[model samples]
Structure formats: C-alpha cells, structure tokens
Target chain A: MRIPLKIGDAFVYGFAVVLVIISFAGMYLMGAKSDRRHVVIEMDKREIYSIEIHEGMEPVELRVDAGDGRYNEVVVMNGEVRIEEANCPDQLCVKSGAIRSSGQTIVCLPHKLVVRITGAGGEPSDVDDIAH
Target chain B: MKRYIAKACPMALAICLLFLPILQGCAINEVREHSKNLFALNTWINIRIYAGREGPKIIDSAVRRIEEIERRMSVTIKDSDVSRINDNAGIQPVKVHEDTFKVIEKALEYAKLSKGAFDITVYPIVQLWGITTEHPRVPTDEEIREKLKFVDYQKVILNEDEGTVYLQEKGMGIDLGAIAKGYAADEVVRVLREEGVQHALINMGGNVIVVGNKPNGQPWRIGIQDPRSDGVQQHIAVVEAVNESVVSSGDYERYIKDVYQKTGVRYHHIFDPATGYPANQGLMATTVVAENSADADALSTIVFVMGAEKGLGLVEQIGNAEALAVTVDKKIYTTKGFDRRLTVTNEEYEIVP
Candidate 1:
C-alpha cells in the first residue's frame, strides 16, 4: 500500500538528522577546545603554580625561589617552557632546554624544584612513562 | 498517513538511542586515577593507581613503605643500616634489617653474575667523585687509585643465618643506590597488587615499572630517554610493556655541567671500579627490561659499564631479560628478544643488527 507524504513525518526525519549532527559537532568542538596544555611548577613536593598554554599566547617569565638564596628563572612562550636561569650549583635545569610536549619535565635536584607539562590534550600521550 | 508517521517517529527515536550508550560508555570506562609525587631515595617518585575508592590509602601505604626502605638503606642517613655497616667495616659484622640483608644478597648476586662489573663496593669511588653531591669535581688519578682499593665486592661478607653484613676492608662501603630504587619499585608493585590494583605505573626516578596493562586494556608504552638530549620528552625509542620493569642508566642523568661546558667532557656519575673513573665505554647509555625491577636496575649499570658487545652478550645469557645499548656514535644494539618490542623514534639513531 502506498502512503502519501505527510508534513509530520518530514519534520520527524529532519529533527533526527539535526540531532545527530549536533551531537557529533559537540564532541568535536569539545575535543578541540581542550587541546590547551598546562605547565605545572612544583617546589618541595607541592604545586606552586599552574598555567595553561595555547597558541598565540604571550610569553611569560616566572621567578621561582627555593629559599636559601636559590632561584630558577622559568620562561613560557609559544607553547614551550624552559628554565632560562638557575642559581643551583649544577645548572642542569638550565641546560635541560625547552619542553613543549606533555609529560616533559625540568628538574633541579638541589632545590627540589620540578617544572613539568601535564594534561590530556586533544590526543592521548604516546607513552605512559619514560625510562632514563 | 497516521501509521506512516508513527513508524517514522519510532525509527528516529531508535537512531538517537543508538549513540546514547556510546557516550555513556565513555564516562563509565573512565576509572578514577589516584597519583602521588614525592621525593624519596634522593629522587622524585611518581605513582599512579587506577583502582577505585581505595587508591589514596594504597598510595599512602606505598609511600610509607618507600620511606621505610630509604631509612634502612640510605647511606647519607646517620644511623641507617648501611651507614652502620660502613662504620663497622673490618671491625665487626653489623646486623641489618631483613630488607637490607635481602638487597645486599641480590647486589652480590649481580656482582658475581657480571664478574664484579656491578660491584656494590664502588661507593668509595662514588664518594671520591661526588658527582651527585653539591661539590662535584674530577678527582686526581692518585686520589682515585687510593679509593679503588676498597672497590671490591668479594670483600663484602654476608651471613644469611644471622642477617648480618660485614666488610673485610675498613674503608670499604656498599652503596645500594643502583639497586635500591628498583627494589622499592618492586615493593610498591606488591602493595598495589595486594590491594587489587590491576593497572598502575610506578616511576622511581627514571626506573619505571608498569602493573598490568593500561586501564583501557592497551599495553603500557614506555619511552627510552635520548641520552644526548636533555629534554625529558626527547626519547630515542618507545617500547610496549605489560607488567614488566624498564630501567636505563646514562651519563646524562648526573654530571658536572660546568666542567662539561669548559672541557667538552662529561664527568658523569656511573663509575667503573676497575679504572676508578667514569666508565668510558663507547656506549652513551644502557637500558634493561626484565620481570624484576631490581635485576633490571643493577643490569642497566652493569651493561653501561660493560659496553655494547659484552653487555648484549650478558643480557642474552640471562633468559627472560632484554637490553638495549646506545653507542656514542648514535647506534643502538639490542638483544635478540627485543625484536618487535622496541621502536626507534629518533631519526638520528640507527638500530644496528
């Protein structure tokens, strides 16, 4: 049996299509927006500072003091972070260079300071842990 | 027309319902993550657990266990069992905690396995260089020779019946720094498994051990740090592991940076007891993967000092163990068992047969 096209049926089909499209778009947009990574600075086993990094963000310099006249100069610019200067004797933190990827860290053992990048961005991290 | 409209409505509703469970599954599959970052054993320790509700308590217990281990094993601690043994060297046998006794026994085993290449008595030479200490300097050859007399593992006498350790030489010392972290990691794993944690990651300094697979059921991926690069993410290769330990010893870990810049020579921490100098073997770093973390830890150092050919040979002789040696010339040599397990990610390094 043949049934004539009805306005109500057309409305139902259109609504379903729109709903599916919106759901997909919502997931995509949410993923894109959360791609911003975070740089966390920890001193003495406590998180002292945390900042988000994204494209086109202004560069920021932070002075982290580790008491007893020790400090590390941290620079965050262009989605990359590094210790530009440090008063620690080893100076290993300064030589560690810039880190832009998630799970990267700059550590000053003498000062008990750790600057690390953490967060689950748009994509998951490739590795769970690093062996060195 | 009414019947047709009824059918269309139900069809559209079914389509929406199809995706509802998928979105819900994403939320349901997300197991709670409990993590702790603390400094112990003179290095940063990071532990993560995926067990629900009971994770925090488990982590606390694990931290306390590590602290206790450090208290017993640390050489710097005033009255640690190791310190007591060092003080009583050549005079008397010092009774130690079971943990300390077990670690010393394991150290001696590795020392024998590697034919003294992995000596615990290298502590005197380590103190001489003081690379990890605030005052790191290249010791004079004469000064090193003086300290090398005490770098003999055979001189360390262990009594299993009495749980005591004695050193035959007065100045001789035993440093568990190489193997203690791995043992601590193994201890943490035991704690997590007992508490029914199926998925976890324990990184004691750079010694990494993964419990089971990831929460999502995929194998855990571990990156081997690039020895030439200082950036943490600069890994030369990646390896997938399941309930196994991966450890690497490299010159880049601790070194005299000021001396390196001026002289272009890195005076790193890992020392060769034979020469009383930094192991100048042609390799830059060595990584070991094994079922036991302590074995992997001690073997990494042993391999680094043994160089590529000998190290790879040693790894092959020991079944259920694998190793990768990165040469100073940007080449990687791996044991036969490492086939299909390691993937070289850096372009500069070539995997040589």
Candidate 2:
C-alpha cells in the first residue's frame, strides 16, 4: 500500500510531533505508584485487609481479626468480597461492592478496619497486620 | 533469542538486498534516525532493528512501511483498506492489506483462546454508547441489550489465502481499539527485523514491546501505577521481558470526566458487551503480559470487562498469558508465575478469591 502524501497528513503528523515534544519535555505531572498492588490493616475490634486482583479466578483467604467480638456474617459476590452484616451503623463497607480490584475497597472505619489490594501477585495473609 | 534471530536473518537479508540502495548497512542507517512516514498518524514512535543492516535508507523504508499500514488500517479513513473491507462485512468478502488481514486472523485466534471472552465485534456496542466521543451519555438498558445481540467474535469470518474478512451480521462492526496498539507494536518488531534492528523499545502509550535489553544490558523497568497514590508513583519495579509484550488496561486510564468540577468520572471505555454499558464488574484494572504484545492489549480489556474470576479463568484457559489485577479492595492478584515477577511492598492489600 502506498502512503498518501497529502497536506493533512503532514499537518497532523507535524502536530503530533510537536505535542509529543511538549508533553515529554514539559513537567511530568505526578504519576501513580507503580509497585505494590495491595494493602492490609489491623485495628482494635477486627483485622481488615483489602485484596487487589487482576483478570482471573483464584481463592483468596482473609483471617478476620476475630478479637473479643466475633465475625458474624461473611459474603462474596461478583468479583468482590465484604461483610454482609456487621454491628457498625455505617455498614458502609458492606454496602460497597465486593472488594475486587486495587481501586475498589472496603473500610470499617469504626472498627478501625482496613483491607486493601496491594503489589505483585495475590499471595495469602495468615498473620496479623499489627503487633497489638 | 540469538538462536531465533540467526536462523531468520538469511531470508530477510535476501529480500532486503533487492532494495539495496534503499537499505544499505541494514543496521546503523543514518536516514532511519529521522525520515518520517507522513502517513502513519504522526506519533512519537521508536523502533528497534532486529535482523537487517542499519543502512540509512532501510530505516526510512521500514518506517514508511508502517506509515502505509497506518493508512490501510485507520478506521477514520473512508477509502482506506479497512473501511472498504469493513463496509462490506456481510454482503461480500472484503479484500484487505495482508497486515490488516493478519490482525483479523490473530484476533480470531485469540478469540478462540479466550473462548469468545475477547471479541472484536464489540465495536458496535462501543459506538452505540459513544464513550470516547464528545456526545458521551449513558445509554438505556434496552438499547444496550438489543445491540449486544451481535457482539459475538465467532461471527467474524476469515479467508487467509485471499486475505478477506467478513462480519456475519450487517450492523456488526469491528473495533481494533483493543488490539491495534499491540499489533502496531508487533509491526514495529516486524519492521525492525526487516531493517535489521537488533535492540529496541516500542512503547505505544502503555502497550510496551521490548527487544534484547536496554543499551546497558539491564532488563527494562516497567512501573505499574499505584492506584491509591497520586501522580506517577515513586516505586520502580523491574520486569524480565526481552522480545515479549506488556499491556495494561486500567480504570484510571480513561474516564468520562464531568464538564464542571470534574467529579463523578465515568469509566466508559471498559464496557461489558453483555450489559451494553460500562462493565458493572468490581474490577478496576487488568494488565496482561504475553508473546505477541497486541494480544496482551486486546485481551487485557476483555479480561477487565470479564471481571476477576471469569477473566482469570479465561487467562488460565488461554495459557501463555498472565495477568495482574488490582481490585477495588486494593489487593493484587495474579496468575502462577506473575507472583515471581512482582516485588511486594510492606504496604498490605487484600487478595480476593
């Protein structure tokens, strides 16, 4: 196939070059963290850890920091996982979709609970997040 | 890698010599450093030569070949090869450039590998929603569900010898957005080999395909974005990719930002062909590393829309392709060897089943 040497092609190509130079040369805006795809947190009442996932299927286990109060309800739906019913009023964490990707999350603020997705591949968590 | 290049060079050299003056030295060509192919949608593209001599004119010829392909494959051009072929998807066997036909053939192969989980026919649904266009608006459920009737990849028909493509349905359209970049990355590899480019890094936005290693013999360092953190994250992770391709599709990349305060950003690009709107799946992003680079690009989008479980299932079933998913919960999950390639931080994230 022959490349058409029309004026528009030149103009457009020229524009792209200029744009590339400007963008690369210009101050680079802040970028997202490139490593560590997940994070887990342990609080007073229970232990919370969020899991980050990619395009696939695998069983991920979360050892709920069952302190004095127990983990009453647990549920998994779609690609997310969350507590279906809890003692907290907000129930905000449960209301959110099953914690699926690094972007989607569940937080039990009152329980000081935080479970999130983090880096590399999805490895399991059998230990406590905090010393307390 | 050396073994593969050694056996392939002799044939490439013979074909390259026929255009001798146009392709001298095969490796360090002066003209190749600059001569722009005015037609290949002017973008800042870098090519690495793999097989031929680096003669000045050969790089220009190789780049020009890419420009020619850009013309042949662009969907916006009415007279281009893709348009004519796509226009006749149902009525006739639309003849096309070998490159275009090759992409279709590969997409078909990937479709089979993914069990139709990744489809090219999603274009109709994409256009109907007008996600990337200025007229972006949420389409009704009925509208989306109705159009999804033709969103099957199996409907794509191909004749390899004749280089023809046909869409079984009249309204069914093909969107190369998912895989075109990867194919372009492959084309860069193709041209580099044709022009004898031994080492190169072709980064089309996030779709990356590297050759050999860096000039210093170090593996390329590719940083996957930290979704929680702002801007480009500080952490740089090393990846082992010589000739292979790395492609990532994430929710943070493209979104329909609100016109006013820029709140309520709608992620419209990763739509569920089944649902006809943005995929309601919980996944926020998906990235795939694979042999062809382009497959990684297209498959990543398909897998993202498929959600983690189904998407992971599809990846495992397809084989050769490994994925890393960051669910909304901030956990990172990946296929078998994917764990080995990643560097875990003290920061913790949940790993969903």
Candidate 3:
C-alpha cells in the first residue's frame, strides 16, 4: 500500500469526510434540541378554556369563560408532573393540576381565566427577533 | 505522479478547511454592524453618542443620566422611583424621570390599546409563573387569583405634569419586560442625536433603534430570524431611512425544554396578561416597525398575544402603525403598503391575504 492514497480515493473519501463533518456539525449545533418554540394548543373544540404551558410549572394561560359560567365545574389539576383540566368550581384547579413537564398545565376555566405551557424554544417562524 | 497529486489534493483540502474559519470571521464586522449595542455584553448598555463636536461625550453623559432614570423608574428592580410612585399611586402627584414616566405612561397606553392584553403590572403574575428562570413551578389557583389582585396596569399611575409615578396598590409591582428594551432603544437613539451622530444603530438585544442611515448613505440590512429555525438567519429587512425602530416579538427565547409530551411540543416566554397565561394567538411571532423602538418593542408583544388577525386590526386601528405576523403554520401576515418594505426568504412564506 502506498503511503499516499491515490487521488481518486482521496477525492471520494474527502467528499464523504466532508459530508460526515457537515452532518456531525449540524447535529452538534442542534444538540438534543437547540432553539425551537412550538405553540401547540391542545383542546376540545367544544371546550372554552385553553391551557398554555411554557417552561413553568404554573399554568401560563387560564381563560375564564364568563359566558360558560361554570367555574366550580371547571377543574384544574397539577399533580406530580402532569396537570389535567376537569370540571369543577372555576377549577380552583389553580391547585388540583399536574403538569409533568416544566411548562405544562391544565385549565378548566375560561373567561374566568386561561392556562398555557411553553417548551424549549421552537421555531414557528422567525425567532431571531429577540434571541439575537 | 498519482501519489504526488493525491498528496497535493489533501494539502489543498486542508488549506480550504483552514480558510473556512476566516471566511466566517467576516461576520465579526458584520456582527458589529448588526450588534445594535455599543456597550459590552451583559453590561449596562452604552451607545456611542455622535451629535457634533460636543456629541459623543455629551451623548455618553446623557446615556448615563438615562440609566439612573431607568434605575429609579424601572418596574423590575424594586423601590425605584417607579416603585415608590406605584406605592403612592392613589395619592397623586410625585416626580420622576420625564423619560421613565413617559415610558411607563406609554406602557399604560399600550395596555389600553390591547384592552389590557399588554400590561406592565404583570410582574406578580410573571414571577408566580417564573417565565425567565428555571424551577418553573405552577402556582396554586388561589395564588394566581390573589396575585391577580396586584396585577393592574391602571394601578400604574403616572403624572406627566408633576413628573411623578405611583403604584396605586401596595405589593403591586410593574415589570417592563414587555417594553423596557424598546424604551431603552429610544433613549439611546435620542442620546445619539444629541451627541451629533448622524448615523447609528442601537440594538438592545433584538430590540433595535436605527438612527440615520450609515455614514456611507447605505441602508442597514437587518436579518429577521426565521420563526422555524434555530441559530439561523431568516429574511433581512433593510432600513435605508433613519429614525425607525424594528422590534420583533417571536415565540422563541427565554423558555424551558421538555415541557410537553405530545409530539414536538415546546414552550415560549411571551405570556398573555389577560389570562395570566401564555397567549393562544395563532401567531408564532410578530414584528413591528415604528417611529421609535419603544413603540415597536411593546406593540410586537401586544400584537403577538392578540394573534395575526386581531393583532393586525389593532395595528390598523392605531393608524400609522404597521406590523408583520408569522403564524404557526409558517405564513407571514404583513400590513398594507408594507410589501415594499419586507423581504421574504422564499416562497415558503406568503403575505396573509
């Protein structure tokens, strides 16, 4: 075997090496998850209260449904790590909730309040506006 | 012959790779050009003053003066002029920095526009949720309800004539996270003008105030981050004319990771003050262009929480205000007559019909 590889081999391997480096760099840059904030609103269309969770154990948005007028029936539960929204008095849920994730929660109340959750910064559009 | 060529190719490849870093270094000047700040990182900002022979030095003095005003008038740090004024909110008539008072007053004005969707008195509510730091623990409903009692923008009383600010309720606090950067940008620009700087750009983080065009009479190109990418540049909006603030409110930055279990769920920082939660507005990000940075800064958040449709309506309702909103589905909603101003990255984004 020659100490110096042939030019053909060098070019082929060099291209492969480039591809690998690029892939590795991109993966490293993104890491497990770099910057991306996806605002996902999960709620039954019929349900008026939408809870938003964002990196906070506390519910981010708690909408109070003045129109519905059944807060007690609206139940908000933050248990262990998972928060759930159920029917109860305005869900005073302020308490009975479980948002297992950092920014997770449940809201049974709307008009009377709102609940929200945030995840690691995900890009829905142009995020550099503030991220610098 | 084959061996020599092979060896030469590797050397050439190495040279190219080595030069890659230097090529990227061109961004240093680019970064400085786009830096938006004259002060060092993580330090109280210092914008270069350039009015005339007396400009730079005078501007420096003026900015220093403004920092003191901000300290006394800021809603974040406790017991500044704003805190005391907020304490005596009901008493009426106290003195404050004209600029600080104006900024708070402006925040109040924004609160009115969004119908309280943009309130500065959201500190209690925000702190309860801990949007900025880790250990984000969900507070009790009772806790939120009780704290809600103290979150009232109306409680932020500013007497312009008396140069005083007051918080009507005890334990009530104001957090300018909503608009301080913009306000700071405005002050820095004003200082630059006073210092006789014919051309300068002051960017407090992403909140930017572009004074006059560059000395070469060229418009400054500002890159808007793609709402869907990370550490990537999106569309660039070039500002040729002077005296404009381009502030964007996107759903990125200041958030916690692993907050959701459903497929691809991430949380954002901007919260909707009305619900004492993050806003459900369909908009992923909102950018505002205004005569000053403060207006751009505050309005971006307001419109973001308001959503694309309603947010545009709010901007239109104000008259002379323009906005660009990017929806979660990757659609860009820009205002009428703004088409000429915005540069879309590709066909991926369409101006909302």
Point to the candidate with the largest TM-score: 1
Go through the candidates in order and give each one's DockQ.
0.37, 0.01, 0.04
Candidate 1: which docking quality band?
acceptable
Query: What does the interface RMSD come to for each candidate?
Result: 5.2, 21.8, 15.3
Please provide TM-scores, in order, for all candidate models, with all chains considered together: 0.84, 0.60, 0.60
- All candidates: CA RMSD in angstroms? 6.5, 22.0, 16.7
Q: Which ten residues in a row have the lowest lDDT in candidate 3 chain B?
A: B31-40
Query: Tens-digit lDDT track for model 2 on B1-353?
Result: 66556544653554444344333323323321221111233232434332323444555666666667678777777877667766887788888888788878887787777666667788778777675565666677788788898798888888877788888888777876677667877776786666556566665545667766655566655555444432222222234666677777766534554531265545557777666667756766677878787778877887787778788777887787888777877777787668688654426454434
lDDT of 1 by residue, B44-68 (tens): 8889889766688999999999999
lDDT of 2 by residue, A1-132 (tens): 333456864665565556555544432331133243544433432335444444443645454544567442444433445566666533545654355443223445444454444443334322111000
Top-lDDT candidate index: 1
Candidate 3 docking DockQ: 0.04
